[model samples]
Target: MTALSEYERLEAEGIWRPDPEAQRQEVILSLGDATLVIADDRSATALAHWSLPAMIRLNPGARPAIYAPSAEPGEELEIADETMIAAIEKVHAMIEARRPHPGRLRGALIGGGVLLLGAVVLFWLPGALVDHAARIAPQAKRVEIGRKLLTEFTKMTGQPCHSPAGDKALAALAERLPGQQVIEVLPEALDGARLLPGGLAIVGRNTIAGPDTPEVVAGFLIAAQRGAAGERPLHRMLDWLGPAAALRLLTTGDLPDDGIAEYAQELVQHPPERPNNDTLLHAFREAGVSSTPYAYALDPTGESVLGLIEADPFKGQPAPHPVLEDAQWVALQDICSAH
Candidate 1:
């Protein structure tokens, strides 16, 4: 776009030192995005970016605007007036406020003519889109797409599984995991757990076989399944896809190839919204798993997990399953850290 002003040129003069410790400069003013990043000029090479939003002012006298590189949160110096500073601060505030509120697909899009509008798109070209995707995307492509989406985040299998011990334990529990459920308990699932468009249930390493017992893992699984029941897996997928992309998928049954990367990554890095307790409890009951075990697994003293136990679906009886052989349990524990 526009040419840089003389002052702007001076502001951009400083470089983001990669080394944070080497320079040892305290951050004066930090704000914006998701991280609180500081700037260092000397050890420009040693700086590491944080997830919280932050701003750093090199010259206290002149409040210069700083921009960090997309790949690195290293800082750059620049001059700015009150107007610029206020604008930047406002943007920072807005993004921070929105960060905690996650996106969901239910009532957010379920009103009046939304579903009708989506249905109309289907009539325009019946089977055309699905057929096209089928032609281009064979089983291999679908598997790849599924894998890409799956690996994007650290998913919890709701089993607290870690090593092959985790896998074997889950395998034993899997016999009882709702017959319709397709659960995947990874040793190091990045995201907690989520249901996908298909019947795929993503899980994290800390889920079923983490440090907790099978009870906690089963609790989360029940919660995820309940969430899926309230909202279709396709709806959850569409919710994460955003409005424009959802419409495109409804119209053509094909998602932009590149969009999958970020979507998958979000699965591991971000936590999904939890369904209401009523709905979560309903699913837990359907799964025939106890709430006490999961509740205790969630929090021993019941401070944090008190609500979950109080909301237990079945206070009746524990499901039947074999404990893994001690050796197998050890294997599952090491699964997440394998790579």
Candidate 2:
């Protein structure tokens, strides 16, 4: 407030326009403590007081400088007095020097660095921790957790289809598919095949009752493998289940029942991502299973899965072996129907 002592009694004549459409009138402009006062010179009545900090000059380094209360709106003062203009500029410079300017190059860099650190803490750290947890988990532990998930899934979907003939047939089907160590057919609440922490893959009874060939079922298992994307199913599960779940499993050597149940419920609610054409074709080739039946099962007309059908690994030839033997296919189809 006491900075501009030299301009204590500074007064100037200025043309004031209250608005754009109003008539301009000569007014007395005086600087007060932290304010610029505009008064009717003849009537000696104050017209307006603009806070010095808020006042903005419309034209800098121009004669008869124009100013307004703010960068917004139209009330303006046109002043010709050089002394008043110079004093205003000096006060503005002092104010600018004291204000925090984060937009400055050095400040911007510091602010950006802070934001980057915050992003790593909020997003990247949790993901990295989950990956570490998954990487360190032994295959034995993964199989243990996977069977536990199967037990939980059964609670929501009922017991998986099983019979003397069906179990043997399903075991044969799993053997035929390869890479499918644990395969079960759920009665309900399973949208698609969900590969669990170990090499377990669960499918719906509808797919069995629906598709003519077991190759469609094998396709579902291959698609579930794509969900891992070269990562283990445990990693995929922990990623979706979040950092808390990963930490729990890592520290306690088991996930909380609530978290496991929630994951089981969520699994039925969401379908696993489909395997892309290239991935499915590669998997089919590796397993010696034809991809055409599976491609058609995905899209009856094969319109959307044209790539899968055309790129079938066994396009010109039959599968190296049947996906299921004639009797096995019939027995597998009757697996869920038995009980």
Candidate 3:
């Protein structure tokens, strides 16, 4: 009963010492059932039975390794055999695996409870339950989902533009923005801005770089914050994917590629409709941003978006602060080129 069947015949030579005062002697070394057997080389008489699990190498990673039966004061052996040292380490690892895992049983019970609860909820109200799951999903989970969606969207959108300096600059802007959104720039794949789950927004490269001022881009972002009377993108995604996708996300913390593929395609193909003017103005006012720049950006003449131009929120007085510094805007605009 050796540590392993393959190592049953493994043997090596080593020098052994019976105790601190005993003279060193050459010995025959061999592996036994969970033990290291030391024998008198001349007589072949077993002299020691060192428990493999209790063995400790005093000099690790050096030639002629020194080993003691345990940490306590005891006899020691010096073996330059790499094979035996590896086998001993493997036996220790096996013993470690057999040790009790703290809280494993408790964790399993909690996970089972969660799965059972999710199942019961799905059985009752499929649609409503899915909506609730998406709405209440933790921010970290939503961020995970949103990042995955962006990766998938790249199949059609190509890669989103990113560079070290640009990403740092964009992150700074995101911190100051209303939703603290992760905004990505996609070249030509999108003509307008669209929101994803979590606080992620994707806008066309042209939309971000072409605008004369960051306020125009900021308007597009604030409008995407609340779509068509406050129905967020999370709800829209669940509705499109149906209850099955939502339930899967809640239970498994992920969605299959097939489940989200079609929606990702649809999202890239059809950009979100323009946010209502009243809602847009309200968002602008709340975000401490101007709407006229956005209106003029939308219609250079400001004829079609005259209502937004007239009802501009930051019109009467100066803004508390600009949307972004001149340098930050330049860095963000340079993302596509740098990438």
Candidate 4:
């Protein structure tokens, strides 16, 4: 492995006890491509060779780590050297990377054939084809689709709000979400939040402007994440366009610009689908944000979103962390204003 090349023939002094009954002895630990060679310090005689792939860290994240061969539990190696421990961890990661992923090959084979056939079957069996395509399409393609959709979406909603301070605040807010997905704020035309294809999320200007606390914005972001988890954006897109367009996307990696533009126009006018209250509450809990603000924002009367408020994750307690700083929230509120 290329990762091993950097530490070729690297050796270190380590205390290796042969067994539970034996006293610890200083051993010369030599790094090998596939094995760790332990030798007697004085005589330079080989003691034991541990397979790199089979080595397991016993005391993970400890100062002085312990390791043993996965198969041979009777023997143990204690290592106090940080460099040696880091090397072993790196080698383990490299070996794991080489192992075959269970369904990757099968998915690739199926994905290759599905595109053309999926397009034809889309007219008669839209749901199945869309689900299959959404499952099979690679992450890169999903990102591409999301970007294209955003471009089209911008046509109807206007350009995303961007000021130097606002951009920084937006980025900080995005970091709170899983994967640090891009969160774009639209000046108008959006009712609330929508998760785009890939990990992108879009929110309306009103969502930020209407609420006094950043918790509401954070709650909406978590709700968008919950909605995206419930339904993949690619599946939604394919359902909107049908088989022929999906086939074109599968084969050529693009959809008609006109179709995307039209869809964007329709999407701007409609609010994104809301996830069930339970799912949203779970999301809010995970993000350490209260659902009360979002609940009241959805309905000032608090009648429709009573469930969210009643089952609020951080109800009657302080949040684990503030969603945004006071300054950041102020910057975010004036995102559309010129710097």
* C-alpha lDDT values of all predictions: 0.52, 0.84, 0.82, 0.82
Q: Give the clash count for each candidate.
A: 74, 0, 0, 0
Would you list the clashing residue pairs of candidate 4? none
For candidate 4, the lDDT comes to: 0.82
Task: Please write out the lDDT profile of model 1 over residues 1-339, one tens digit for every residue.
Answer: 101121222111233343444442433323323443344544434244434344443444454555443345444534354644554455457656767543443555565367777776756433444434334434444444565566554433223334545555556555566632345666544535666544466666665445544566556666666664465554555456555555566566566756766676665666566677666666666676667776665567988767667766555544544234445445545555544
Candidate 4 residue spans exceeding 4 A from truth: 1-125
The TM-scores of all predictions, comma-separated, are: 0.47, 0.64, 0.60, 0.61
- Candidate 4: 10-residue stretch with minimal lDDT: 1-10
Higher-TM-score candidate among 1 and 4?
A: 4
| lDDT per residue (tens digit) for residues 262-329 in model 4 | 77776777656788888888888888899999999889999999999999988899899988899999
- How high a TM-score does candidate 2 get? 0.64
Candidate 2 lDDT (Cα, 0 to 1): 0.84
Residue 184 in model 4: shift from native, Å?
0.9
Top TM-score hit: 2
Candidate 2 lDDT trough over 10 residues, lowest sum: 1-10
Which pairs of residues collide in candidate 3? none
Better model by TM-score: candidate 1 vs candidate 2 = 2
